[model samples]
Target chain A: GFAELLREWESLENEYQNTQETHQLYRQKLEEVSKLQESCVAAITRQRKRLKDMSPSIRKCKQTMTSEEANTMEEIQALIKERPNIFFEMEAFLPKKNGLYLRLVLGNVDITLLSKQSKFAYKDEYETFKLFITVILLLFAFTCQFLVSNRIVDVLFNFLLVWYYATLTIRESILISNGSRIKGWWVFHHYVSAVLSGVMLTWPNGKLYQMFRNQFLAYSFYQNFVHLLQYYYQSGCLYRLRALGERHNMDLTVAGFQSWMWRGLTFLLPFLFFGHFWQLYNGLCLFRMSQLPECTEWQVVMCGSSFLVLFMGNFFTTLTVVYHKFKK
Target chain B: GFAELLREWESLENEYQNTQETHQLYRQKLEEVSKLQESCVAAITRQRKRLKDMSPSIRKCKQTMTSEEANTMEEIQALIKERPNIFFEMEAFLPKKNGLYLRLVLGNVDITLLSKQSKFAYKDEYETFKLFITVILLLFAFTCQFLVSNRIVDVLFNFLLVWYYATLTIRESILISNGSRIKGWWVFHHYVSAVLSGVMLTWPNGKLYQMFRNQFLAYSFYQNFVHLLQYYYQSGCLYRLRALGERHNMDLTVAGFQSWMWRGLTFLLPFLFFGHFWQLYNGLCLFRMSQLPECTEWQVVMCGSSFLVLFMGNFFTTLTVVYHKFKK
Candidate 1:
């Protein structure tokens, strides 16, 4: 992205140099204005004399001049004096030199979103809000699943998942509408999660649910806990940056962000990797179940595969963004 | 987006004005160069004398001259002359009235991607390629279904659906890797479709499959036909624009694009609406079936709801993009 900006800058610089050279040439021409004006006057006088000689012969050939030709000679003389002056005036306004160069150079620079080096509006506040909600929701879900295991509890947690993610999708859309740095992929991630959770809520109680119930709850609990940790850490960094009046750098808190990386690498990433692998394991398990003669839970295979897609997508996206930011 | 460009241009102009004023000031100072040089020499001599006076006292306080004291007098004299020269050099390089103003203004102009007024990379080419493959695959499946109505044919179509959408997901990922404008929702869309088709392939031959079989194939047929028409028309416009040496304009051929709007509105949109409504009708049918006593195909309800989600997502996305392009 910076590559495009750099290229644009180079072109603008070249245009500026060209315009400066042109301006210097024009200035030189202006320096000899009196001499040029004298030459023009001489040329005009010569042309007038030639026309005068021709006019007498023409008048002899014709009967009389039409009314339209009454001021033809006088008008021609006036134009000779005025035309060059007007030409210079128009040329001065054009982008060849002076003020026009500014327009030419600036007009061509493409301003993109990623290249936006400006302070983002409501960036920290939005992140903080997101963190607050994530912490509350995750804490609630983690507690509900950890302490209690019932159909109602399962339903409640699923409802929370749907509501929280649906809310996230809405908030993210608003952020995007405001031109925040959140990518479309991140928003879609929430949409998928929302749909998945909604479907999970609708899943009928059966043998498949009985087998996978504890595993699913534990996986979700760990996920929420990791996310909760991340949100708080990120929020803290953002708040500190905002308080220090580094508003422009709210998104780039690298020093504090390193701590997040440390925590992730040492603690969260292993668990995330485990979860990713576990999703594949789940898929395999479902596939094996589909092969069993008595199993009627073939739909679990679809669920497992979608979960695999989500996990893989999440893992890859996280890695990419982290790599991108870290490299920067 | 051009609005952002105009704003940037205005700011650059303002900076140019400021630099111009600074350049005028510097030029005035340069005119009295000899006078300024004399004052600089006087100041250096005075500072050197003052340092010498403090040297003895500082030596008395310390055992020997520290590293800082070694170059005190000479460094002070050198710096007095050097500092102003360096300042002038730096200022000259900075944006200022005569020549440097361009550099200053251009350097500060921030170009962002969403704000990008520049030409995008060839995204349509990749999408066209994707559409081409989709059309071929869909047409093949449609033909197979029309000619043969056995369980094998059903499985064949399902397999085709799985493979095609999987390829789409992969291709979309590659496009995203290359920074095309394709969003995450589109990738997720393909992923969901791929998984759905996989599930459909796995669905057992039963009363349910028999009931939904013809409807699904017809839907697929119409969907592919609409997409094929759209892709060809769009690709033609892009190719023409490219041939005409309007590479940057390949994405923004609204004059040529109007033809697409006309076609979509008159011909393709009706079919698209029909398919969309049909998805809803399928959902309603599945819902009613779930309410019936003997019906055991609760999975259809999930299938139908997901279909509804997919349809709504597709419809909204198309509407949004069209509205955005039309508004532009």
Candidate 2:
């Protein structure tokens, strides 16, 4: 019980810290971009809404406009309606006297960029390979963990599982930016999984955030491996059999090998995370609980409740998900 | 205070156990995928549907082909329909399976060229610029967490904000892969807030993840500035500006500058996180409690919440989607 409590505490603290840090960061950044001011709220809302009503219909005359052009016009019109309210909203907060004149001069200026200066990007090769390996390994580890039920194994895998997700979350966000979409369930798969990471890694210190980042160098090998495997599969591996084909060079090694390694790494996390969790919980519990000199029964009970919750809420969810996954 | 408790839980334990070593790495590597076993849930469901459709059209089709051919056709059709379900569902478990499977396999299984293999691609001048300025800065102190918040001027500028984010999460992940995205948002008053990074990074991670990731990089330069200027305009900085232009590069420059200097090299985490939160909360209570905190709280809360929800739910959805995608 002592060891388990310690383990539970460790997880709770780590998770708490991570969540706190993340929330703070989000608050700060979002503040940076927000342009809301109280004074103009009423006016801006009224004016903007009025203008929105005057805009053209979506169906069009079917007459003389393309949907694309109509859509563009609609967007521009929306902005136009929003402009007055936006301006008022911007104005509401201005000191009534400010370089009042300076304010006027500044307010009328247009500031859209002619071209974007740059785009942000990150890289993660290991994460890439790790993900592949995770998928494959998860498929395997799911079975292993279910069979063994080792807490340590659960810790390692779960930790990596969180990391793996962080990687995937970032990947899909980019894909969405690039227009990765699905018609109904046909292609909507990418959008759902990110939520899981969103939930699991939503901690205080932002460790998961840090861990979830792009590890391009590590991911490179994975990309190469996948490409190579796909190519090889498409090319047909080197089977120099008699009349099987007019053969060309087969360069299918990178992807196959990459997948092999990636899968191995991916599933390994659960084992690693769980093992780590178990060891920390066990040794610590055994050592600490046995030597307690003066502890209240209430404290012990609370500790026990916390541990049970941690296991059921976090570890159990992870294990169960991993379990059913492998069972499949 | 009540809300805070609801928002997060402070775990009792601080140390995590190391249980990642028990599983044999070799088994993961050697699991040969032979006869793939997937559940027949889809099959049974389909059979039920087919039995229900005893319409004239169904009878006509049944009469046109041999039983064996018809059976084969149905199987193919079922397989085709089930393709998306497999990919989408599979992706949820993928990270644990291995890694992001992006590597392209070449013919002969020998050569594999990944799009991200060329890390940092020093081969170009523009990229070289990114490497020299942003990249280098990121590695040393990363988003400037190295810089502690102190002197009014330093605090006002939020000098280390860039360094903190770039380093802790963005840069570190990029370090692993060598991919990045660089884009910026232009604010009013020729104020261009260019939110850009270096490369697309790689898939074990990517830009999408980073954008959605909520983490505290360092002291808020904008927040600091907002504080100094709060008296200037009752509504804060937004009200102060008459017409915010987006043409100038000043915002980008301001966003990038980071200061990691502290009176001493204290880790600054507790001070930065808990101390600041406590201080802020105290100050806000001095006001109306709802005034200051609410302004920024929503963003932080929303972003964190969205991330959490998306991370947990999206993966499951993606697995089925990816499968359908590949199958199609």
Candidate 3:
């Protein structure tokens, strides 16, 4: 019995020692990791300096260009292939493992779709296609909403919203992967809008639907109008700028940008703000109503919450961008 | 009459010359733009060379860290505040306009939530709170599903999905804004999922709902189980790695990552694949059936399409990541 007790104590001591050693090993590895992170940050900082030097060009490009284009695509791809290390160097600056993640995802897609010279053209082509499809769909929805806001029309619009946004999300993602400048928040904004549109489409023709139909239609009209303006303004700017020889510089500054386009955006901001505020008010109204005891379905609650989140996110993000731009 | 014709010809000639001059002006601008782009690319190349020199540090960082940590918040904020130029320099390398967008959005949010020393501690604290709340909710849902799979439970779960995903989306966005590398696709993925869950929750307990109940339950179970597994694996890895001092590096390499976690993921992949395939099949099946005259509601078609989209997106993304990692 005494020998057994002594053996058990020795086993416990060995287990503790092993645990201590493992902890020590992990700690050492962590120190190595931190040192590595510092170097990565340093590397990122150096890369950033290079980018800063090109700010004038970048700003010029932004003034002229609307979004990623065929020429820029070629330039970016050429750089990546010829000097993969540049991508690796800049990788330290991006979030988490996304630099590699993007490379891997895009690399696979590029192999399939971007065969050679055609690849750069793909994005431009896609933009053209997207714009064409969007215009057609928007026209269709406007006609339906204006002429006959019936169940079938609502359902049709819902289907279109789902399909269009899904396509937009997919395309936008590809663009981001291909080094386009669309923000995460913008993509997220699209997603929330999609969900709201989908919910609206599915809403049955009831008293609630009747109450909100005009407001909803007006909101859609405003959104589509803004999109049309943005599309044209951006495209025109890009065409002229590209013709002038500016490429890969979309800094969205007042300098070098067409005065007319700036004026148009300035004029449009109030409408956008009004629409955003209306969404906020609608959400508040719905949320208040949903609190009533007579509310049979939780759909009201869910819908209200969705509106709140979407309005808050959209309002905050849009305002922040505007405030910063205006402040500057 | 002859004198009048001569006058018109002279006017036309003047107009033609003016057009030619404008065209020439555009051509000059185009040349300037091209030269700017070239210089920007050259700058980027130089930066890349510098980064290449620090490859060992990059590689080492990649091997050790799981993702961004709480500590880097201060460093990133300070960099953004002090040398915003660095952010701008790095901007050219990122997807367009994100640098400014991120600064505007995060800078606003940071002022509210992140105060001095507490800023770094906030993420960890938030993560802990999220985990605690998630566990409680998951347990409650599990109990409800297991014991009472009724309309109430369905509604409850729907609410939970919406609330959870919305919260998660908001939090992930904040993290992204603060230089976290969570992908845009992932956020979009959750939004689609939330919409799907919401639709399912609202579906009346009828022929379609009855048909889908068991399958939906099983699907939900698997999804929740996988989420639980992922949470533990990710959290455990992050905690241990943090203790070692690594931050903002998540390479997903096998070296420092726990083998069991990899093994678990590998084992789970087939099941996930199977689930994805089943979703596709279910979508096809529903779509085919919905085509029949008896199917009055188009909800069937919408749900089917949603499933198809979700399945394809998830499958392709997952396969791409897995293939890329494993091949390496």
Best by lDDT: 3
Per residue, candidate 1 scores C-alpha lDDT tens digits across A210-240 of 7777777667766766666666655665555
Q: Residues B1-328, candidate 2, lDDT per residue (tens digit)?
A: 2222212211100100011111112112212210011122233334335434423334455566767756754664554465444433322211111112222110011011112222222113222333343333343333334444222222222222322232233322222222222211101100111111111010012232332222323213322332233222222222212133221222423331212111111233223334334334322332342243334222233233322333233333334433642343
Model 1 steric clash total? 14
- Reported per model, the fraction of native interface contacts reproduced equals 0.05, 0.00, 0.00
Ranking the candidates on TM-score from highest down gives 3, 1, 2
Give the higher-lDDT candidate: 1 or 3: 3
Question: What DockQ results for candidate 2?
Answer: 0.01
RMSD of each: 29.8, 33.1, 23.2
Please write out the lDDT profile of model 3 over residues B1-328, one tens digit for every residue: 3233335435533543443444344335434433443444444444445334433444444444445532343343343243234433332222222233222211111111212123234456445645665676667657655778776666566656655664455455544544445567677777777667656644655676677666666666666666666666566766665664554444565356546547767777877788788789878977886877767665677778888988988899888867765664
Give the Cα error of residue B310 in candidate 1, in Å: 10
- Residue B265's lDDT within candidate 1 is 54
- Stretches of candidate 2 off by over 4 Å are A1-131, A134-136, A139-143, A182-328, B1-167, B171-328
lDDT at A14, model 2? 60
DockQ each candidate and list the results: 0.03, 0.01, 0.02
Q: Quality of candidate 1's docking, in CAPRI categories? A: incorrect
Which window of ten consecutive residues has the lowest lDDT sum in model 2 chain A?
A: A111-120
* Docking quality (DockQ) of candidate 1: 0.03
